[model samples]
Structure formats: structure tokens, C-alpha cells
Target: MRTVGNDLVRHQLHENRKWYLLLGALLIIFGVVLLASLGMATLSVVFLFGILMMVGGVLHIVAAFKIFDGGYRWLWAIFGVLYLIAGYYAFTAPVQTAVVLTSLLAIALIIGGIIRIINAFMFKPLPGWGWTLFSGLLTLLTGILIIASPTSPFWVLGMFLGIDILFQGINYLTLAAAIRNIPPSSADV
Candidate 1:
């Protein structure tokens, strides 16, 4: 029986190779720029996140009012208010926000990497599964290093983000190559 990874790779190779290539190229370009301007890029990311949070809070508050007859509306309203406070803080204290956000990113990376590794193992015997495992391990290690050093440079956040994206681009390129190299029929276990 072919694993889900085999079917996914086959489908992507046959149907979305161009999209994969485009995404990989775009990520690589963006990653390079972020790495080049680590401090500025980190500030930009924090600012953007703040703006998004403010917008989301406003939207949620508006939506809560729109839902006239539901108890859930109150829950939404509370969340909206909390979001507003958080968003305001983010804007007012961007450097602190960046640090907190970076910590959250590290936690997310750690969790996501663990999940990916487990998923990769589940797709065993499939072609390129090792690549997925390797990517997951890298991600896990990066996250651990970030968490271990809270007093690192401010630019660490941006550098980490850039490195993560670069790896993602490489992973995409690697998957594309693997899919292109192996025929669908040959992927079956």
C-alpha cells in the first residue's frame, strides 16, 4: 500500500510542480532579504503583526455586535476587548512585542517540528520521507536553541525567521526534485 506521502507527491508532481517552484523561489527571495536586514525586518514583522491584531480585534468586535441573539457574542466581545489591549500594547512597545512574539514563534516551531517528525515517520517507506524527517529535526533544533538563549541579540528573531524560511524553500525544492525524479508507480511500498 502506498502511503499518503506517495499519493501527495504524485499529485503535486503531476498537478502542481509549477506552483511549488514558484513558492520555493519566492520564499528564497524573501528569506534572503529578511536575512540581509535582520533588525529592520524583525521590527517590520512585529509592526505588521500588531496592525493585524488591531484590525482583527476591530473586526471581531463589529461581528459580535452583528450577532444579536447569541451567547457566543459575549465571548467574542471579551476576546475582542482583550485583543484590542494586546494589540495596543504591541504597537506601544514593539521591541518587547518582538521578543514575546519571537518566543511564541519558537514554541510553535518546536511543536510543529515534533508533529512533522511524527508525521514523517507515519509516512515510512515512502520516497523522500527522510528529507521530511531531516527538516523536522532542523526545525526542532532551531526552536530549542532560540528558547535556550533569551538574552540573545534583538536581531535573532529576524535571523531565525529568515533561516526558517530559507529551510522551507530548500525543503520545497527538495520535495519538488524528489517528486520529479520518481515516477508515481515506483513510489508504492
Candidate 2:
């Protein structure tokens, strides 16, 4: 028995099921292609990041002029300039950019894992605290391995991106299948 909200969601999903299917197929193909050409994919990711940083810089500069006032305006402008410089560096030296980004990712993961472990201990009285600690330990180990691995900076980001896209495509495919299974009510016709 479906609630009204569930029925409505089903109806909407059913209506857009084809789009989901198409997106899923496209993403899956792209993910496979990325995984096949890891080096190219890595460079592509770096280029995309550069483009995003440049776009952000432009937006920040625009905001400084159009939205911010007084000291905020200067701060925004300064940030915009910094973003632009970083973007330029990313574009000019993608390999270096990847190394820097990978290092940052490892550091962030380590910090996040430590925080989670601490939180798990703090919440020891709560159920599932053990799972939290386990997850934190796993994350910490992964970060350590990434930092220690020689190949990490070259392909880790691309590999992660490919896997993420693959999972997302699977998710969409599953959603589409579920939507297709939904029964059409009289109102749908």
C-alpha cells in the first residue's frame, strides 16, 4: 500500500524514467572511458578544475564590484585574484596541480578520520559507536596508504572519479527500474 506522497513520487519518477535511463547509460559509458584512459582522465579533471576555479574567480570579482561593500569588497577582490592565480597555475602545470590536490585530499582524510574516531569514543554509550570507530580507522588507513603510495598523485583522483560515476550510473539505473515497476493509476492515463 502506497501513501499519497509515495504515489506522487512514483508518478513523477515514471514520467521521467526515460531521461534517467539515458543519463545512466551515458554516465556509465563515460565512467568506463575514464577508467580506461586514466592519464587522460586525470588531465581532464585538472583542466575542469582549472575552468571551475577561473569561473569562481570571475564570480567573486563580479560580486566584489556588484554586491560587496567597503572592506568586504576588498576581501572578495583579493580572493578573486588568488583564485585566478591558482587557476592559472592549475592550467599551466596540471601534474603539479594533481600532486598538490592529492596531498590536500590525503591530509583532509587523515584529519576527518581522526575527528570521527574521537567522536566515536565520545559517543561510546550510543549504539553503532563501534562501526563509527571502524569506519574512521578504515578512512585513516586509506589516507595513510594514499600518502605512502607512489602512484597516488598520478591516478587516484581519476580512479575515484570513475568509480563514483559508475556508482551514480548504477543508482540511476536502479531508480529507473523501480520507476518502471510502479503501477500506473487511472489518473496517470
Candidate 3:
């Protein structure tokens, strides 16, 4: 019962399975390394974030000039300046930046979790509502834990990032295996 699209997908997946395997292995290795050195990972992320913010700030400033006729040109310039200032602070005081970022992350997670929990209830008639509810609950709990834990600012972001990467690697590996096993199309016969 395979359609043409399915056959095409199978062919493409089989052809690219090696790449997926390589990417998954690399990600898994990175995740493990990050987890092993949470402090270094956190600092590394902060430094990278700082650099990105600086780049974004510069872009925004350039964009402000590009859109000189726009009514909100001043606003854009202001935001760009603000971003530059923030980026400078991030570079100068990464530890403080991490704390602020982690706090923001916790707040966001809390808000998102609440929204998801509410949505889950609204979608209770759907087939997998329980999973949504569970995920929301987990997110809410993690946020709370981050806020409550005194040491969270130092390691939470790194730990969560590492775990996410590890899981992503696992997902890619699983996908690679599945793709590798895709049945050959009739044309292959």
C-alpha cells in the first residue's frame, strides 16, 4: 500500500542514513562532554550568547539606518543600543548574565507550563490529552525546582541543554535506524 511519496521518502532516507548516523553520534558525544563539564558548558554558552547578542545588536543598528523613513526608526535604534549594552554586560559579567538568563528561563517555563496544562484540559476530548497534561506538569515542576534551588543558576541551564542534546542525538540515531530499515521500492527489484 505504499504511495509514490512513500517510495520516494524511503529512497531518500536510505540514501542519507549514513549522514544521520554520523550526526547522531556527534551530538551524543557533544552532549556527554557538556554534561561532564557543566561549569565550562555554562560559561561557553554565555560567551556564545554574548557574541550573538553583539552581532544582533549591530544588525539591528544597521537595520535602523536602513529603515530611516519608518515611524519606528527611533525605537529600533533604541532597542539596538539596549541590546549592545546588554551584550557588553554579558561579556563583562557572564556569571550575573547566567543568573538573569536562568531566572528568565524559569519564568518562561512556568508560564508555558501553565498554558500547556490549560490547553491539555481544553483538549481532553482528543486522544493523547494525558500526555500533554503530564508534560505540562513536568515542565511546571522543573521550573519550580529551578527557582527554588540556590545552585540552579550555575548548572541548571547547562544540565538541561545537555539532556536536550542527548535526547536529540538519541532521536536522530533512532531515525537513522528506522530509515536504514525502510523497505526497498519495487524499482529496486
Tally clashes: model 1: 0
Relative to the true structure, candidate 3 reaches a TM of: 0.83
Ranking by lDDT: 2, 3, 1
Worst 10 residues of 1 by lDDT: 180-189
lDDT of each: 0.81, 0.88, 0.88
Model 1's lDDT to the true fold? 0.81
TM-score of structure candidate 2: 0.91
After superposition, the stretches of candidate 1 with alpha carbons farther than 4 Å from their true spots are 1-34, 151-153, 160-189
Where does candidate 3 clash, by residue pair? none
lDDT of 3 by residue, 12-69 (tens): 7877889999999999999999999888788877887888888888888888889675
Per-prediction TM-score, please? 0.63, 0.91, 0.83
Best by TM-score: 2
- As for lDDT, the candidate ahead, 2 or 3, is 2
**Local lDDT at 6 for model 1:** 72
Taking every candidate in turn, the Cα RMSD to the unseen true structure, in Å, is 8.7, 2.4, 3.1
